[model samples]
Target chain A: MNRLDDDDDRPLSPEEMLRLIEEQQATTVRRLGGDPLLTHTPWGITWLAGFGALYLNYAYDLLSRSTALAVLFALMVLSMATTFFAQRTVSSQVRGEAADRGMMYGLSWMFGFACVVAICVRLSPLLPSEETGLLWSVTSMAIVSALYAAGGALWRVRTMFFLGAWLAALNVAGAIAGPTVHALLISVGAGGVFTAVGVVQWMRRRGGA
Target chain B: MTGPRELDPVIHAQARLRVVATLNTLGEANQITFPGLRELLGMTAGNLSVHLGKLEEAGYVEIVKTHRGRTPTTYVALTRQGRRAFEDYTATIRELLDLG
Candidate 1:
């Protein structure tokens, strides 16, 4: 690599300099913003497979309850781990206020879920076994949707906010419809939402939108 | 306040201006990899190194060399002095344009 002469001194007009600054800043943002598809697709698969198994176990008894629970637990854990590491990978690439914000946002998810667990454990003994399961699923979904909504609002992403709203509605309908139907609703409905959103984001990025 | 303020000579050049502008987007404590900044500015490594050396000399940017595993990596960050200089430069520009 050859170093060029350092004697070149040219002045830019104020308007031109401002324009250049704006253009370069925009380029930096575009280059550093991580792909949404990577974050969403794995989650889509996890929800689809996890809830599908739960539906099978509850509705058709195709798998034992313990087996279904284990599968769901494993998939959820895997999805969470994938999301955590994916975020860390992106954060590792750049350092700024955005990185700190991302860390806080990630921690917020853990905090939200912890509160859900605490609430559920406290409420579990009052409900029957079957209702306890229903309570756990509904509360968990509620927390997820609420967090998504909060995240969307924080990030100013309209699609994420709408997705959270849609999922919240689905949670209500599932709760009213009972556990078996709730499992099926989340399996197809929420899962489909995740998959569809991932595809749309992928397409948008490919199109340079 | 009486005479027109001049832009910082170090940041007045086109390439150096763009470099400072790009680095300005980063958080105060945040650092970007050498290749990362180079890619952002679309500048060759040698050219960027030259400009960065000037900035470092002026206390505008800090460059650190550290090992990431077995690979040596170069990270660059804007310093408080540099950020203040850039801010002043922009304010001066805006003042010149009568927008400030």
Candidate 2:
């Protein structure tokens, strides 16, 4: 630890200052860029509940489209409510520029997702009845996965990249598994994985690490 | 390029420069705890306090001491002046490097 003293007031030249600034920025980013609440327990539970609702909705689609959609809508609303509460809790503990950036990134992702969904809904009438739902789901998942990958690269977070890869692989599995099996896989397998990651992160933070 | 004399002396020292850079990287509105800053810079608490004191005296950074339950916690954030100083410093550096 170099203590700055007025007696030793040696000024850094422009080049030296620039080098020091870059060094400091790199070190700080490595230190503070990660937010533990990113995979919080509340977030994990919300993912599980939300994906479970979607699973049920998709499984029932063959029997009743309208009913399935209604369930899905209810689930979506519930997921959003839970997420809102989760964010509030996490924000109280994690207050920093990183948190602010995460919120901005989340908002952008939601906006992009909404746009993709709207476009898919508009195009669904043109597609064959047998393929419409599957096409929409795959497309949405692929887009989200790609965005996650891009974000991971930008932020240098390996977990985010793995998440993107997982989602993309799930899309492939969905294509082969059919709607019912795919829905089950999403709810029980993927949701469980997300929850487990969140739990681990929560525990680490609680342990003050 | 801004002349060396035009640069703020209060922000010209190496440790203080690093301090300003770290705060600036976090964004102008962000406030970091004293422990947080110390950890970020890998500086001793006494060393960090001295640099922060200099910055505070120059009105470049603001320090707040508050009680969390019974314990006192120190928070540090760059003032508007500090942010501007950093921006100017970076711009000057860029100009110098571009010329070279």
Candidate 3:
């Protein structure tokens, strides 16, 4: 967290420095909508890492090394973009009283998850087939989606909450019924949920001051 | 006109309140940036800088300055001593409030 070298030119005593850190921290919480959850980076980080690992596993087994590499490249690009976007939305104070960009951020992880899924589904037909690994792969994707959902809720992101709720439904249904139900979930359910959320966020942004 | 209320007196300072409470919640590095502090407090730069300077003078904060794109930025983090002081402050308040 401390990216700077210790300033030994230190005008303040060790005692004074501690005081400043405390004061700044209190202000930070207020900035984050006073949400208790945002203070803990590890909470965000755990899901972020978990999702990354799960996606890695899904992409790692690709039959064509080129495809895997391509997917990896996509991940890097999406991650950098997400970082840029999240920073822009979060750091900027809402222009008006009702403007909470937290809701808008749902599309962020949705975009992230979609990238991975699109790439994986694209590679599906290209793989060797004695072992389908279909059920486990679906389950894994479902779990990753659950994390995304839960994480979004924790972050006060309505978009993520919906994604999480839907993914949870998909996880349970898929576990019981297998890939027979995937097309419905991937197409109708996910599309419906993302569309509804995206519209709501846009409306809210327009409505805000 | 009897005794003080149960709320922690030490959290009286707003910026310190953010730092202590914020750090209290985390295990990994307890550090944040000027932008984060800005958002958390919703304060203008001058106002925060004033309070932060006071806290720095008090040894309650550790400021680390760095440059990006030729712009200098500051990172503020809580010290171990600061953490204990805040914990004690909170504990005393909790005891008074029977929150524990």
TM-scores for candidates 1 onward, in order: 0.69, 0.52, 0.47
Looking at model 2, residue A41 earns an lDDT score of 38
Evaluate every candidate with DockQ and list the scores. 0.43, 0.30, 0.16
Screening candidate 1 with a backbone cut-off below 3 angstroms (N, C-alpha, C), the clashing residue pairs are none
* Tens digits of per-residue lDDT for model 2, B12-94: 77778889998887775677778778877777889888888889998999888877678877778889988998888788777
Could you give candidate 2's per-residue lDDT for residues A118-149 as a string of tens digits? Answer: 98889889977545766665776677678777
Worst 10 residues of 2 chain A by lDDT: A35-44
**What are the runs in model 3 whose C-alpha is more than 4 Å off?**
A1-84, A87-143, A146-180, A187-209, B1-10, B23-28
Which residue runs of candidate 2 sit more than 4 Å off their true CA positions? Answer: A1-13, A35-169, A172-209, B1-5
- lDDT at residue A16 of model 2 (Cα atoms): 77
Which stretches of candidate 1 lie above 4 Å from their native place?
A1-27, A30-33, A206-209, B1-21, B27-30, B35-47, B54-75, B78-100
lDDT of 1: 0.80
By TM-score, the better pick of 1 and 2 is: 1
- Candidate 1, residues B1-100: lDDT per residue as tens digits? 2227977888887777888888887757788889888877878888899999989999999999988789988889889998999899888888877943
Clashing pairs in 2: none
Give per-residue CA lDDT, model 1, range A121-152, as digits (tens): 99999998767878999999998889888878
Winner on lDDT between 2 and 3 is 2
Fraction of the real A/B interface contacts present in each candidate? 0.64, 0.51, 0.12
lDDT of 3 by residue, B1-100 (tens): 1124433333445444554566453323445567765655555676667666756676766778876568876777766766676776655544544532
